[model samples]
Each structure stands twice: as structure tokens, then as C-alpha cells.
Target: MPKYIVEGGFNFYEELYKSLDDELVDTPIPDDTQNSTNDFNNVCLISNLPLTDKFVTLECKHKFNYMPLYNDLVNHKKKYNTMERKTLKCTEIRCPYCRNIQNKLLPYYDDIEISKVHGVNHISETTLIMNQFDNVSCKSYIAGTCSHEYMCSDGTTMPCTNSMVTLLCNKYYCANHKYFGKMAILKEIKIKEKLELHAKILEAKKKILEEKKKTKLAAKMVKDLAKEEAKKVKACAKAAKVTTHAENIENVIISTQSGCVQLLTTGKNKGKSCSCAKIYQNNLCLRHHNLINKNKPYDGTGTNYGNPEQAGLWVQWVNGQEPEPDTDPDPEPK
Candidate 1:
């Protein structure tokens, strides 16, 4: 039965029981609960805060707070330009995440209520409606927001309409600040980078063309070598055919014993007749006659008709008789 009393004399137990009887429940969720449990999709990728009014959406679908994005762009304009030659322009805007070139950042609107905890302003529907009537095409420069402010040569601070109009050092100044002096060194560096990139591209193209030419030349050489080899093979085949025909003609034998000249038939020498003039019993020359005497019982005495030291073989039939000759010899060798 102890009572907790604090400033303004408020009774904690009395109020707590009264709220419980009224079915009043107080649930306190931590502020970082959403940030810890969910992905950072709803948060700005740049500021790492929740998105609210006056945000910019890039073509890559990444959202950023407007002021931070404008400041980043302004910083890039003052710093070095690292984009490729294709997107090399003074007003080039790029996404910080992917470094992809973007022409403009589209406006992103949220319908959340303005609160001190959110720390963002709420853009009304009337403002959007009036923005349609704005003559300036650039959305970031609308209502003189995110526009460049520079000190002119005449000791005057002037604001530029849009970032589209830019110079070397102080970016996006009006035409009156043209003669405020330019950074010649920065201009030279940019020109040198562009020239080097162009030279590299030309060199790459030249190398590709040279490789193509070499490939074509190699193909042609192989084709010509193949044609030459084919010609040599055809010539060798023709020469072999002619030589075989001449040898066949030289091998035909003629017989003059019975007043009849004909090629041998029905023997091992059927396709090739004898070249000798003298014949044995079957009208075969000594060389062709010896072919039939193989494996026959040999008589001690035999005659080699042509010469004793000749390449012809001689043997006498002991028990077997000579085979009967064909009545009609074939006109052509077998």
C-alpha cells in the first residue's frame, strides 16, 4: 500500500488502475525497431534516414534526400569528372551507388505527416499543382531550391536559374559571370583524358581489323596448299595407271609352234604369259612350264631349256603325267 508520488502531485497507482479498468493499454516500441527488423529500402541511401518530402529518385531506382543529393552533385561539379567519354558533359549527374549516368533526378513525394521526430517537411498537393505552371524545366531548380549561388566579378552574390548553365570552377553561374576567369588547368586535363580515350578506342579497333585480316590470309593459304596437294595426288594416280597398262602389254606371250599364237590359259600364269620363245610340252615357255612342276617327284636329270645359269627352274615328272591342255586358248591373258 505504498503510493508513488512525483512532480505535479500525480498518483501513479490510482491512474494505473483507472487506465486498466478502462482497458487502456500502452505499448512502447523502440524507435529503431523498424530500422533493425526491415531492410533499408525506405531509408535514403545517402543520408541513411527515412525518406520524406523533397527527395530525388534516380533512374536506377535509388532515392536520396534532396539537399544532400544537390550538395553531392555540387561537390562533383567542383571535383573531377570521372564519367566515360560517351557521357562526358558539364551537366552530367550520376548515381552514387552504381555510378551510372543519369540525366535528371525525378522528384519523390511522400504522404507522411510532418513531425519533429521525422525531421522532414511535408510537400502539399498545392505546391505540386503550382509546380506544373513553372516555366523552368529543371525540377531541382524549382522555387529557387538547390540552385547555385556564386559571388559575381562585381562583388555581388548571384543565384543561377539551373545547374544546366555551368563553368569550370564555380559551377552553374549566370552569363554575367562568364568573364570571372576559368581554370585553364582543369580544362586541359579533361581534354587530355578525352583524347587518350579516343586514341585507345581507335587502337583497339585497328587491332581487331588486323586480326581479321590475318585470319583470312591464313584460311586462304591453307586452301591453296590443299589444292596443290590434291593436284599432286591426282598426277601420281594417273602415272601409276599408265605404268600398269604398259606392264600388262609387255607380259602377253605369243606361240609359233603350231602356227598359232595365243596367251596361256588355265594356269598360275593366266594373267601373265611367258616372255620366252621356246615352249615345253604344253606350249608353255621354260619359265611358265616350271611353274606346273612344283611338288612333283623330281628325276635326277632335268633340262633347263634356255640356259643353265638362267632364273628359270627345271624338274622332271616322275609318276604324274602332264595336265591335259585346253583345246582353245584364251585370246587375252587372265
Candidate 2:
């Protein structure tokens, strides 16, 4: 039996074990839904604080305070380098909210001061002057509040704080103080505007349909023209049977009696005598004659026309110019 060796003393091994146990107890395993919470009030997921100098992850779109996220990334890299086996290794630089791998983050500037300065009172100077000329308050005196006062449906005048302005009448009134007659008028105006938009959309759709139909009709016409052209080309090819090299040879040999005695050079009939009756001027078939003479006729030009007198089978019949008249002795014997 071998005894396990412990350095320092017996207490050293115990102390090391205690430290390891403490580390295991203190560090909790990372959960995928650790940051999944309903606290989305413009707060950082890592520090749980209002996001300042916010940096949003490109992949997750999760907003975070710049310093906290940077620190987390650094810590994660350190842990990974130290051989810490843990899920959601920060070295990969994951988004704290969704745990998605993040390579870059974009700055989202949402300055409260700038927003307040540019809120309601940021109307144009000309519009301000026009409001002053009309003896009406600019309607937007402060941020998040309306300055317009109007009579309610109850015939009582009240101050409105809503920032909404009706597109039809340009009236500024809160929900509580909105007049019924004005509401009906706004509804009618909205309905009419919707109807007009729907009509325009329908007209656009109708135009698109007409364009599609015209395109299909044009395509059909082109296809019909192509078919007609193909039929004409086919008829011409049939009429001109000697257009190809082989067809020209067949045309020349149609009136011949015997074929050429040239041997085949290739294919299954290689080394065999050619049976083609289309003899050329050299007493060989057109193909064999071309090969021997090294003559390349353009698209079988010289193959169709040849000297018919050079045919080996052609023999002139030599008969006397006049035939003898039938004898009277032959008629008597009949």
C-alpha cells in the first residue's frame, strides 16, 4: 500500500481542502436565465443601475452601463485564462442579458437633459410668432405638458395637460376634458382619411395588376412569334435536304449506281471498305476524298457537286446510229 504524501503538515492538506470547498460554495454556476427579469426601466443588467453612458450589444440589443460591461468582460477573460470551466465564459464576450456572443457594441445616447431641452418648447421661431399673433398660447409651454385650455363636453372650461393635438381641428385637450362633438368630428375626419388612403392603395394595386397582365400578354406574344419562327426554320430545313454534309452526299449519290471503294477509317466500320455511292472526282467517296486531298469544304460545299463521268459503275452504251429495218421474210415466217 502506498501512502499519500502531504506537504507542510497534516493541517496543510486540511486547509487546502477547506479552501477548495469554500470556493466551490461561494461561486455559483451560471444560469442561462440569470439576467432574465421584468426590470426593464432603462437599467443595466450587470450592475442593476440606471444605464449611464450606455453601450448596447449589437446582437442582443441589451443596454448596459459602459464601465460595468467592460469590467465584466475583463473578469470573464481572466477566468477563462485561469482554466475556470464554467458555462457562459465571459472571454467570448457575451451579452449580459441574452448571453449571446457579442463582438461589438454600439453607443446609444439617450441624454435626459437634451431630451428635456428639445421637448414641447422646441417649435420653430416662425411658428411661435404665428401663435403669438393668433392670441393663442403655443400649446406646448413645457416638457410633457400642454398649455391649451378649452371647453369640455360638459360646458365647463378646463386646462388641458395632454401633449396630443388633433390633426383635423388642431385642438389640444386631455382625455378627461375632450368634447363629444369634437371627438365625433375627429372620428369622421379619420374615417375619411382612411377611406382616401384605401382608395389610393386599391388604385395602385389595380395598376400593378394591369402591368402584370400586359407583361404576361407580351410574353405570350413573344412565345407565339418564336414558335412561328421555329416552324418556318423547320420547313426551310426540310425543303433544303442537302444543307448538311451527310445530306449533300446522299443527294449526289441518289442517281449513282455503285459506291466508292474507299476503306472506313473510324467507328464500328473501321478498316472496312466504304459503301457510300457518292463518288467524288478522285474515284473516292466524298469523306475519303476530302481526307486524302485535305480539302475542308465550308458546311459541305464541295461534297454535293462532282463529276458523274468519273463513276466506276457508269458505262456508256455504244449502239449504232440507225437500226436495221424488219425484213419481209421474218413476217412470212411469223
Candidate 3:
């Protein structure tokens, strides 16, 4: 038996070895005799155990942060060797305590002898094989009745039932026909454009109608003004015609009485003689004849012509002599 010296002496050694043994009992190891001792020494150092032992240990002199019992280090080394031998090639190596990749302190170890010789095998170059779906149907997914569970790389879960999936160039997608699919998005954009166009059309039509109404109103106003102007012109023409006819009638009366001189009988000049140079009917001037006839009473009617003085003039003119001027005849009897 080789005697070993723990840095913390025999009392500390007993306590540390007991604890390390308990921990190493559950640890796994790798196989391969050529580098097994070296790999085991690395594991012991990582576990904060001493690399030297009373019986046998590696000759490599590496410094450690904490001292460990030699017996515990040997035991842990044995466990690592056994685990290495039993494990399959290309298996991942992780830290037993932290469960993270043991990359910093530990070297790569595998069951493959050629891989160890070449030292080309690395944990970073490892690839995981994904499981394939043999019974999944693409047509059923498009029909919105798929029963597959689609999982994303970020650990998100989604069901395939009542959903659409589009496959293109070895990539999968979730297609939402009502909103998010490529065709649906394009359709929405088209509908929005159509609505905008329709609104513009309606606005243009409204403007056109408004313009037409303005035009029609202007035309109607012009027509009303024209009609009023026509009425005014017709009224002025009718008045002119009436005035011309009256003037013609007056000229005809003057021509007929051109040389008449006759006593008048009616109206304000009833007792005066006509001074006209022309005469016709009843030896009276046309003016006097017309006036007398205008004053004549109807058949069997009373002779009240509203003026007594006019009646007296008519009586005097009918006697065929001028009436005497008004004067006091003779002094009445005192």
C-alpha cells in the first residue's frame, strides 16, 4: 500500500473522503483504457477532489483550488472510467452538478476509438435528428380539418385543427384565409381599394348633380325673365295700338267737320253755335252732332241730365238763336 498525504491532514481527509465517496457513487463514467485515467483525473479535479491516492494515481501535476482525499479521488476516477466504457458514441457530456455543457475544463471523450485518435469529434459539431411525421396529410390541412400538433422552435404549441397550412420550398406556414393568408391579404387590399374608388365615384356624382341643378335653376330663371319681358313688350304694343286708333278717330272727326259752322245743343256749350267750317246731318257741325246725339234722352225717359244750366242752354239752342247774356232786365217794381 502506498501512503498518501492530504493537504488538510488525516482528520480533514476522513471527513472529505466520506462525503466525496457518497457523491461519486452516483456519478457515471466513460470507457477506453488509453485515456481513461487521464479523463478520470480531470473529473476528480473538477469535483474539487485531490488527484493523488495511497494506491495508484496519475503522474500529471495539476494545481487545484481545494484539496481532496486521495481515496475519494481514486473512487471517482473509477466511476468515470466505467461510465465512459458503457456510454455510446456521440453522446453529450454535461456537468453533473450544474447540468450545463462541460466545455471549459473537461475534454471531449467518446466510446469511438477512431474519434479519440483523430481528436476531431466536438460537442459543437453535434447534430440532433428530428422525428418525422409519416401519416400527416397536406390536403387535410388545407381543408381546415388537420389533427396535427405543430410545434415551433421557441417552445410554442399550436393545434392544426380548423387551421390552414401552406407548404413552400420545404417551409411550413399557418394560413388564415379570413385575414392573414397571402391571398386573403391581397383580397382585403383589393376590397379597400374598391371601396375608396366607389366613395370617390359617389362624390363625383354628387358634384355633377349639384352642378346640373345649378344649371337647371339658372335656365329656369332665364326663361321666367324672358317670359316677363315678352309680356311687357306685348302690353306696350297693345297700348300703342290703342293710342293710334284713338288718334285716327280724332283725325276722321276733324276731317268730317272741316268747314262746318253750326249751333251746338248739349253739354257745357249747348246754347253756342258751332264754329266749324264743315257741316253734316241736321245742319250741325260733326262735333255738335256727335255731342247732341250723346246727350239725347232715351225713349220716354225723363230729361234730367244732372245740370239745369246745361238743359237751359239746350232749350235756347233749339230755338235757333243765341241766348242773351245775363243782365238785369229792368228795375223791378219797387
Over the stretch 1-334, how does candidate 2's per-residue lDDT look in tens digits?
Answer: 5576876557666689999999999999887454555456478877888776444544666777766765565555434454545443212356657767744423324553332111121333333333333343445333343435677899997766576533214444433333442545556757987999999999999999999999999999999999999999998997776467677687676545367666665556667567675666655675556445432222333343343321211122122223233232211100
| Model 3: lowest-lDDT 10 consecutive positions | 124-133
Measured by TM-score, the strongest candidate is: 3
Global lDDT of each model? 0.54, 0.54, 0.48
**For each candidate, what TM-score against the reference?**
0.29, 0.25, 0.31
Off-target runs (Cα >4 Å) in candidate 2 are 1-178, 242-334
lDDT of 3 by residue, 84-109 (tens): 44332333333333333322222333
| lDDT per residue as tens, model 1, 254-311 | 2224322334565766644444455454666544444455434444454433444222
Instruction: List clash counts for every candidate, in order.
Output: 0, 0, 15
